[model samples]
Structures are given as structure tokens and as C-alpha cells.
Target: MTTTAAAHTDLDGTLPPLAEPWDPAEFETRLRAVGEERYHDRHPFNVRMHSGDLSPSELRRWIGNRFHYQRHIPVKDALITAKLDTPALRRMWLRRIQDHDGPAEGEGGIERWLRLGEAAGLERQAMLRGDTVLPGVRLAVDGYVNFCRLRSPLEAVAASLTELSAPDLMRARIEAFERHYPWIGTEGLAYFRSRVSQGRRDSREALDLVLAWARTRDDQERAVAALRFKCDVLWSLLDAVDAAGHREPA
Candidate 1:
């Protein structure tokens, strides 16, 4: 997939001269437009996987490498949550942390992803150690987390609007796994299944907050850029994964 400038470059606090803030509906349409144009759903790696063209080596490598991104979700959410003002806002946002981390051990999305690792022929311990994670994947995911950490609370939350497009991707992934990679047990798909619903709920909540908080054209533009940056993050992560065996040694 072709990456936009938003993916590789910093925002640098630039925007055109302020105009009227877009109506909520149009602003949302614009956000969805970014996803439609640049979401990782169309990346060749993903396209190959969905079409049953991925080798077991590639699939296993991806399961492990992608776990690096999954594990940091809460850390990113926590940073954003801290930046949110008011107990009510923090309380609402904290559910994201709980959803990923869960209320106890041996649960949550990370735990489910580890089970997915097991299903894909990776050992739990090794996956936890990020044994198959490539340098580029790490850099990409870390850049995402840092974008959340350093940006405004609103922009950080805007980056999460990727969840807006996530449910369908999760469904496609589940279908792809079942159809193209049947050697993997059905149980491993729980993580993807879980995300289908989680994605909808998260995106709705996030969209409401984003629309409400971004009260100016400048704020809206920055928010859109943040979402674009996130799409690039995912695209870049896949770019790294697709390069698995071809990269030069550090």
C-alpha cells in the first residue's frame, strides 16, 4: 500500500487558515474517507493473507510480530487516558485499558493474542518475549505509542479512530483465517471475533468524544491528521512484516 506523508512525517502543528469547523456529519465523513483511502485493509500483505497466498512461515511470523503491536495498546490508551480531563472522562476511557488488560490475569486481548500465537505454532513464552518481532515492526509500533504520548489528548484519541474501520477488518481476518489457514485451530480466532464488537463500541464512543471536543477547524484538521498518521502506522507495520526475509542485518 502506498503511504501518505502523514505516515512517515511529524505533524509539526501545521494547518491551513482556520475556517468554520465542519458539521459533525461531514467531519466524520472526512475521517472515514481517510480510512477508505489508506487503511491497512488494502495493504498487499493483508491482501495476500486474505487471498490464501501467505506461506505458513509468513503467517507465523506475522502472528508473532503483530503481537508486538497488540501488547502496547493499553500502554498507549493509558497515556491518552491520563491526558483526558475530568473523572467522568477518565472513567469512560479507562474501559479501554480494562478491555485490553482485563480484570485478571490469563484474560484480555493480549492473553487472547497469546493463545492465537499458540494456535499459529509460536510458543507462548517466545511470543511474549517478542522473539520473532522485526526491528521495523517495533519502530513502527513504538512510533504509534509515542504519537499518542506526545500529542494532545484529542489528537491521541483521534489516532484511535482506526477502530472505526476495524470491525470489518476483523471479520475479514476471521474469514481469511478459516478459509485460507485451516490448519490453525478455530479457537485462535477469538481475538478477532472479540474485536468485531469491541471495535464498534469503541469507535462510536470515540467518534462522539472527537466530534464534541474538536470545536474548531484547526482542531478538526489536526484530528484528521492524527487519524491519517495512525493509518500510516498500521501500513508501515505491514510494510515491515512484508519485508521479513529481505531486510539487511542491523
Candidate 2:
């Protein structure tokens, strides 16, 4: 099944069409299947955290470690935004940062995450400074920013498709936090809970943007690859955090 724009020309000037293309239903399936196979919900750490299987210390490590990724949201969006030459593109991408960082200091996802940290017993200063971030997590997120800056806008947006799979993970995080970490009050987990609602709206809009703009077969392939790249970025971050929990005493 190929969509109207699903043909491609190769280096040798041979033409090929994608095995599957943008039939509306097929497109939706492909886009969503990417999330089903690769989303963080499938990651072991996420599984453990949400299943009430992690210890308090493990939960704390996750919160502290993920603060690094949460902080990088604005930075990555800025990098992606820098590559956009059009106000339209800028307008759409900028909202991602706004959604996370909020309109002012006391608002948005980052500050909410801080409240979460404070509730978890981690120091605000340490989290704000990113002093406790794992080295691997930093490397992975930096790579995502670099990919967005260097790749085409379609690809950059595709990389953001992990957000498509994020709402489910957010729900699981909230459920787990509420059930297992009662010591951490609603104020602390409020950030994570808020994100479930926001991530759904944001990711849906972003996915539509990518799908609508990715008209050609080559474009779709690149878009899919970019999404896979993003999944690795997310998966690696979790892997780093989970691995840290297993490190032995020196």
C-alpha cells in the first residue's frame, strides 16, 4: 500500500516505492506502531517504577536522574527552533518549550519537576544546577539536540515523536507515584501528573505536523529514522538511570 507521494529515486537513478505508504489508516498505524515498539513504557526501568517494584531509593534516583532530561527540554527545543527559518515552524516548536518551562518562573513543567524533587527530598539547588546528572544521560540528550540541529525540520519533528508514546508513560508514573510513594505528596508528583495531560495534547499536535508535512517517501523514511533516533535517546537515558541503581559500592 503506497500513498500518492510514496515513490523515491535512488543514487543510481532507479526508482523505488516504499513498501507501505500514507494511506490515512496505514500512516496512522505506522506512526503509532513506532511508539508501541519503542516507547519508554517498554523499558525495564519504567516497568519497575510503574509496577511498584522499585525501592524508595530507586524512585528517588529516577527523579533525580530524570531532572537532567526535563531540564534539557527547553535547550533541545531551542536548538531545534534555531534551525527553523520560518516563523510558522518556530511558532509550533516554541510551544514545546513553553509547555515545559511555563510562561513564568513559578509555572511550567520544569518548576513543577522541581517541586517534585523537593517533595522527594532532593535539594532544589542540586537539581537546578544539574549537578547530579548522569554522564550517559547528558551525552544522549546532547546527541538529540545535535540531531535536530543538523537534520531537516521534518526529521527534527519526527525525533520528537517519542512524545506520541509519552502520555501512557506519564499515566503509569503518576499511578505508581500515588500508590507506592505516598511520602511524596501530591505537590511533589503534581509535575508528573500535569505532564500526562499536556504531553497528550502536545504530542498529538506535533505528530500531525510531521505526518502532514512528510509528503514524499524519502521524507517519511527519514522521519521514521529520526523517530527511532529519539527512542534510542530516551531509552538510553532510562538505561543510564537504571544502571546507576545497580552500581556497586566502591
Candidate 3:
């Protein structure tokens, strides 16, 4: 007897229902599966962008819209940081905000992102302010901040598990953008390049924190759910751009 595709409700029919509670090992497997199946690596725009198939104008749109998420990372970290009671944990978590906001004014990841914006023909000040960002993007970012505020710290850190998979993606994006958008100036791609190192370091630290502290089966389950929520946050942000009537620059 053969089962039809509809018989399986989840992305992989073989897996258990996403709503079901699970042990730590099973939860981790499902969490990683969520990344594998639904992460931005599978986003259509990303596939086109990385394959050098996107036109210059389309590339500009991606950078312009993505600036909102970039600008919100520090804000998200700030929300998480405020909940921490330990000076040591706060000190460790503070680096994520600093990485994006920079050591001083006019520097750091946010500044690097602005350089990409300028190269893409967007106004640096406007992008920095996130003025023209999509409503969905704002909703997703604010949800992330609230998730950190409302959830356990381990779960909050787990939501950032997307970073674990980002280093490689960032490297690929740097190479692809450099190759395809030569007129945009290679130096402007430094934001992607910097993420390769920063993402790996940050993700490793966050992963250690999550896995070490989330000790119960329920804790593990909630942590995985948090990660899935964060993945949706990312996925929906890109979907908003795609759904906004923007297509690969024709």
C-alpha cells in the first residue's frame, strides 16, 4: 500500500506532528529540520540573488528592505538584555547589540549596512531610521523582541538558532553579490562578509547557552518552538517583499 502526499501533514510526512511534545533529542532534530525545510536558504529571491540571476535593481530592493531587519537586531538584543539578572550573562549578550550598533557612532554592522544601502541608491538616513520598511517586517521584528521578553532565556536564545546556519549563507551571499553587482562596488558588500565571522561566533555562544540551560523535555520543546517562531519571522519578512508586487527586476 502506498500513502499519498496529502496523508502527511507536515513538511516531511515521516516526522511527528509539530504540535506534539517531544524529548530533547527529538526536539533538536525537529528544530534542525525546520531550518532545513523553511529557512531563507530556500527563499526564491535568495536563490536568484545568490545564483547571479538577479538584476541590479532587484538587488537594490533586497538590500533596501533587509535593512529593517538589520536595524532591529540590536533592538531585539536590548529587549533580551534587559531581562537578564546576571552581570556576566548581560556582558556576554551585550556583544550582539554592539556588533550591530557599533563601538561608536558612524561604525559597526548598522553602518556597514548603510554603505550597502547607499551603493544600492537608497538614502542612508532613511534606511537607518527604518522609515520605509514593510509593516509585516516591523511586526515580525517586534514579535521577536516580545518573544525574548516573554519567554525563558533559554528559549529566547534558542530563537536565535537561525544564526547557526547563517555563516555559510552569508559567505555565499558575499561571493554572489560581489560577482553579480560589480557596479555596486565590492567594498559595499562588507556587511555580508562580516556576518560570516560574527554570526558563527554569536550562534555558537547562543547555542551553548540554550542547550546547557534548557534541561527538561518541556524546556527543550519550548526552545524548539521558539526557534521555529523566529524562522517564521525571517521567512515572513522575505515573503512580504515578494508579495509586495516586487519581482526580480525585469
Q: Write the per-residue lDDT of candidate 2 for residues 65-164, one digit (tens) a residue.
A: 8888888888888887887789987998798889788998799988988888889888999887887788998898888878877888788878888877
lDDT value, residue 140 of candidate 1: 92
Please report, in order, the local distance difference test score of every candidate based on alpha carbons.
Answer: 0.92, 0.82, 0.80
Model 3, position 106: C-alpha lDDT score: 84
User: Best by lDDT, which number?
Assistant: 1
lDDT of 2 at 119: 90
**What is the Cα-based lDDT of residue 19 in candidate 3?**
48
TM-scores, one per candidate: 0.91, 0.88, 0.85
Considering TM-score, where higher is better, how would the candidates rank from best to worst?
1, 2, 3
Model 3 lDDT per residue over 148-177, tens place: 888877778899899878998988888887
